[model samples]
Target: MKKAKLLAALGICGLILGACGAEDDSKYDTSTTEVSESEAVVKEPGLDELDPAVSEELSKMGTDEEIDWEKINFNKRQYKEYIESLDEQETDSSETGESTLTVVSSSMVDDNTIEIVINNTDASEMSELTNGFFAIMMDTFSRQLYLNSDYSDGTNQPTIIIKDNAGTVISEETDFIEMEETE
Candidate 1:
């Protein structure tokens, strides 16, 4: 009976030692790993490549205007932050994901009704929050421009149109224009 108990204890010890010494499959074995030289390097598309249409539109607007492109570009970061701040207001799962923001065009229609279209797409998931964010961003952008220039000096206020990737109009606000003073 003592011999049987000793053998059982030895078996348990063997099991414990085996389990403890067992190789971990979770850890990657770099020593035996072979990397192929033919592996393709994926490159992200640059801003110019992402939206050629928008670039074309901007180019057509002409550079004769006094607008500060540097300030406008810098303001884009704030616009992004403003959108992120509104995430808590998002109750839909479809609205949460990576997104790309692009200003399609800014056109002054007869020096009164200026139209600005901003195109955005959720990189992963689609949500109402995406649209909501764009709306707020457009408002912010308009406000920034209006505060800096006489574009709102005439009877017409600017109208902004926000669109998504599928050419679907997400949001449009005509009242966003700041009325001009009658001097």
Candidate 2:
């Protein structure tokens, strides 16, 4: 269940990032020099190697301010592995205590968009479940792509709407938080 939630959060973040657009400022060649079948020379530019205009445009695209772009892995294999690790973080469920969150359901609407229904086990709204489990979620979902509008302040209903690349809402979930009092 935890893994499912984390994957959903990551999908949400990726979708949000995909929605941001940045104009290309540089026309640098990306072709590789073939030395051999297994040893082609690739031009992997680091963040510092990018033109100032290009860097500025990327920064504006909601890239995390905390990310050290210089240290990013340019290798496709390594990058994919790093992303997998992020989604598979180890958590001691027994030591973590009871989860206040109850994942009602989740589904992917497209390649990028996903919607998750979260229930606050201890409170009527998720705004009240902003403690233990909330912290865990926030920590795990600390992607810069998360917009302020993605969350509720307890004053309104909780809804998750993930959009496609064309800015069309692919997944829309309403009433994720139950508001009824149990007898």
List clash counts for every candidate, in order: 3, 0
> What lDDT is obtained when candidate 1 is compared to the true structure?
0.50
Task: Give the per-residue lDDT of model 1 (tens digit) for 1-183.
Answer: 999999999999999998986778568555856667677554544333424443443354325544443333212333333233332333223344545555555444443343445555545454556666756655655555443343455354455555554656666666553435998
RMSD of each: 18.0, 21.9
Show where candidate 2 strays beyond 4 Å.
1-99, 102-107, 124-183
**C-alpha lDDT of all candidate models, in order:** 0.50, 0.39
Which tens-of-lDDT digit does each residue in 1-183 have in candidate 2? 999999999999988876653245245445855468567666555334645643454364335455443332223222223223332433222345554444333443332333443444343354343433433342233221121112323344433443322344433444332335989
Which pairs clash in the backbone of model 1?
Answer: 94-126, 94-127, 95-127
User: What local lDDT score does residue 162 receive in model 1, on the 0 to 100 scale?
Assistant: 55
